[model samples]
Structures are given as C-alpha cells and as structure tokens.
Target: MAKLLGLDKVATFFRIIRGNGGIFGSVKTLFRTDELKIGNLIGEDKYGNRYYENNAYFVGRNRWVIYADKVGLNYDGSQVPAEWFGWLHYKTDLPPNKDPSRPKYKWMLDHEQNMSGTNQAYMPYSTTRPKIESWQPPQ
Candidate 1:
C-alpha cells in the first residue's frame, strides 16, 4: 500500500536526511552549508576545508567543500589553496594528499587565505607624486 500511494518516495527522502545525520544534525548542516548532501569524505586541506564527492550528483556539481568554522561565514573561493583549487575544479583526478607527484620545496609558503578586505591585505605606499592631485583653493 505504501508503494501504491507513493509514500515510498518519502522513505528515500528520510533516508537521505538520516544519512546526513538524523533530524537535528541534518538541520544544522543545512543551515551551515545551505544544502544537505551525502557523500564520501574526499580529504581536508591544511586550511581546514573539507572536500566531498558524490558520483550520484551531476558531473560538475558532484564535488564540493565545506570551509572550516574558524572563519565562520567569511569563507570564499580565495580561501581554497592552489593545490586544492585544481582538485576542487576537477583539473586533476587525485586529491593533493593522494597525488604522489605533487612537488614540495623548501621555499614553499604556507596556505594563507585571501585578505583583500582585512588588515593583512597588501597596501602600497608610493613615494612618487600623483599624476593628478586635488587642486586647493586659496587658503
């Protein structure tokens, strides 16, 4: 009777929710990421970004990342490091940790998220006179 009435579809929905983590956990994840997804944990980068992959999902949309809570809602694509950037965008089949050929040199710098709006962002100090300066009225 459940199948006849199509209530079976609802069961699958509940299963997905349960897989995400029961009702409360599911709701929390939904609010945090704006969507509920079930997938295998691909790997996590040094910045604490978590990568996920579910072939069940459509091609481009199958891969995703959940930024670490330390940054709260300030996270953005710029936070994704160059290495993970390639994997996240499907430029490579293997993740950084699993990619044996990835280079690591002594001069390599650590991951630092973009700071365009923050105090750490780059600020230029120019000694040269401006090509166009504001005109001053008789003082």
Candidate 2:
C-alpha cells in the first residue's frame, strides 16, 4: 500500500536526509559526492581517501571510497593504490592494516597512479631522423 501511494519514496527521502545528520549534512554530501548515504567508515589510505561500508546496501554497492579533498572533482580510480584496490575489488576481506601477512620489502617501490594523459606523461626520445621534411614558418 505504501509503495502504491508513493509513500516509500517520501520515506526514503527523509531517511537519507536523517542518515546524513539532518539538512546541513545532506547539503554537504550533495556538494561533495551528490549522494546521501549512511555507512561505517572502514579505513583511510595514506592519500587521504576514506573507505566506507554498509551491509544494508547491496554487496558491491555497499563499499565505496571518497577521494581526498586535494583531488577535487578530478579524482579517478587510478588514484586508489594497490593496497586499497585489493579491498575495493573484494580480493580480501581484511583491509591492508588488518592483514598482518602482507609483505613489505626494501626493494618494493611506492605506489603511484597512472599519469598517461597528464602533463607528467612519459615521452620517448627518437634517435632516428624522420623521412618527411617539415616546412619552416616565415620569420
């Protein structure tokens, strides 16, 4: 009966608002990620990204990460380091911090996000000359 009368949606709206800690929280969340949700904070990475989980939500959808404020709206999945990536993808139930078996070695390099499309992207040096000649602009 509630579903037929559209009361379910109304209830959900209020529930979301309440979960976010009332009106102000809802607005803050809206500006931040545009989604209102309630969940327990699972962990935080060194990059300042925060991970959250809520069993009430569907399995995959229940877990998520909020990127660091420094990334602003430019945040991408690449920014998630390997340690956190494993948890995010359900590779392991325990987070990096909780997993004592994980190995750390002096030879291991620190994680870095792919920079293929940005100004820092790698450029190769060419040793051979081009077959085609370029036209020079008039000075």
Candidate 3:
C-alpha cells in the first residue's frame, strides 16, 4: 500500500522541503550518497552531543555524531567533547560517561566549541605597539 502511494518518496521530499534534512541533505539522499546513517543512540555527552553506532555499517564509519545545536548549518566538529572523541574515533569502546577507567584530572578543561571565524575567537595579548603609526600627510 505504501508503495502504491509512493509514501517513502513523499516523506523524503517533505523532510527536505521542511529543512529537517538540511539544505543539501536532501540532495545527498536523492543521490543515495548520504554518509550519515540512523543508528542506535549510544549516549549523549555533557555538551549535549549525541553519539550513535550501527554494526551493520563498516567499522571505521559505523560510529557517528549528531551535534546538540539545532542549527545544523553551523555545527562544527570541535564541539564534540574529549570523552566522546575517544569513542567516535574508535579509541575506546565505552562512552566517556560509561568508561570506568577514565580519569578525571584537575587540569582538564571543559569542552568548547570551535570559534575560529566568529567574534568569540581567541586573540593573543601582545605588549608590542603598532609597527607603523597612523600615516600622516606631508605638512
């Protein structure tokens, strides 16, 4: 019955149209080249990033992440917490929260999203004055 009405295709079309699938997300789906897969959610990091895994896919590519930020367009990889990073890269089998051997060091810093191109980007403090003063026209 679903095939007769083409509900699958219709549903996909709507997902793309509604922006739930992203701007080019629909394009990727239409081409059958989408890299992301729906998998069993393993856990969510402190930053609210969700991790997923599906053994059905290849080993290295099986694990995936869904950013916590609703604005997928602005999502960045650096947003992933260090603990989750280990699992995402196959460095550890257990999520950070679940790993018993994981250590907590006082020097460890909290996870911070990448701010390279934004106003929040870090700027080093320098004591040196400007090399060239404001240009002055000949008197």
User: Which model scores highest in TM-score?
Assistant: 1
What TM-scores do the predictions have?
0.84, 0.78, 0.65
Residue-by-residue lDDT tens digits, candidate 1, 1-139: 9999999988878977988789997887788889988888999988788999999899999999988879887778888999889998989989998989999999999887788988999999999999999999998
Clashes of 3: 0
Which prediction has more favorable TM-score, 2 or 3?
A: 2
Q: Per-residue alpha-carbon lDDT of model 3 for 31-114, expressed as tens digits?
A: 443343556779987767778888977899889887765644577778888788888998889887777888888998877788
lDDT of each: 0.88, 0.88, 0.74
List clash counts for every candidate, in order: 0, 0, 0
Candidate 3 vs. true structure, TM-score: 0.65
- Which window of 10 residues has the lowest lDDT sum in candidate 3? 28-37
Per-residue lDDT of 1-139 in model 2, one digit per residue for the tens? Answer: 9999999989988988988779997887788887878788888989999998888899998888988879888888999989899998899989897899999999999988888899999899999999998999999
TM-score of structure candidate 2: 0.78
Clashing pairs for model 3 are none
1 or 3, greater by lDDT: 1
Candidate 2 residue runs with Cα over 4 Å from true position = 1-15, 18-22, 131-139
- Checking candidate 2 for backbone clashes, the offending pairs are none
